[model samples]
Target: MGKIIFYEDRNFQGRSYECSSECSDLTSFFHRCNSIRVESGNWILYENPNYRGHQYYLSKGEYPDFQQWMGFNDSIRSCRISPQHQGSFRIKVYEREDFRGQMMEFTEDCPNVYERFRYHDIHSCHVLDGYWMFYEEPNYRGHQYYLRPEEYKRYTDWGAMNPKIGSFRRLHYFQ
Candidate 1:
């Protein structure tokens, strides 16, 4: 099992909560999350309750401040541990919504989509094998989306702020 601790203040001070599973509403434990410590497994932290709003994907690491996770503010209301994906990591990106237009399938991680696929906007995607993180900018920077073994027929279907995607990385499983 994974262990995650949420702190109400930066540097892991103040009230805190330890979670090993999905939490829809973390407000009952703490008013705000200024810091976090991920001892095991990869997780997705949401800015609002019910897994809505901006999200930050974190692995087994330490985040002494909210900015370390690229959070806009100290409002972290929910979190979910990503399940370990078995076998190989495979994904398909489409240039149009509903999995239409030119497509590219990848088993290895793509740091810059333009360098390889030459696609600027990923309107849809299909995660066929493993978990992956899509970035809004090149070199694995900017907004991110954690995709599992599922199908995202549209950009909005995957909770992306826009259809423009520049890079992607396969999630590393914690053993």
Candidate 2:
């Protein structure tokens, strides 16, 4: 099982809440989340309740403040534990919606999509194996989107407001 702790203040002060499973709404436990500690598995923290809004992917580590996890603010209303994947990773990216344009398959991290695919936008994708994280900028920076094994027919299908995908990486669980 995975374990995670949420702190209401930066530097792990104030009230706190421990969670081992998915939580749709965390308002009752705390008004805000300024810090977090992921002791076990990977996790995805949401800016709004019910898993809606911005997402922040976190691995096993200590986040002394929201910014450490690239959070836009201190508000974290929901969270979900990412299942561990022990197998190989595979993913296919498309340059247009509905999987119709140029395509490329990736088994490892891509720090710059344009450098590898010669394209700045990924309109669709197919996660054939393992989980992946899509970033809005190169080097795994900017907005993040967690994708599991599935077919995304459009950029919106991955919860991205735009088709710009600067980088992507396979999610690997760390002990």
Model number with the top TM-score:
2
Instruction: Residues 81-105, candidate 2: write the lDDT tens digits.
Output: 9998989999999999999889999
Best by lDDT: 2
Off by over 4 Å in 1: none
Return the TM-score for each candidate structure: 0.95, 0.97
Q: Score candidate 2 by lDDT.
A: 0.94
Q: State in Å the error of residue 40, model 1.
A: 1.6
lDDT (C-alpha) at residue 19 in model 2: 98
Q: Identify the runs in model 2 with alpha carbons over 4 angstroms from their true place.
A: none
Q: What is the lDDT of residue 65 in candidate 2?
A: 95
Where does candidate 1 have its weakest 10-residue lDDT segment? 81-90
C-alpha positional error of residue 3 in candidate 1 after TM-score superposition, expressed in Å: 0.8
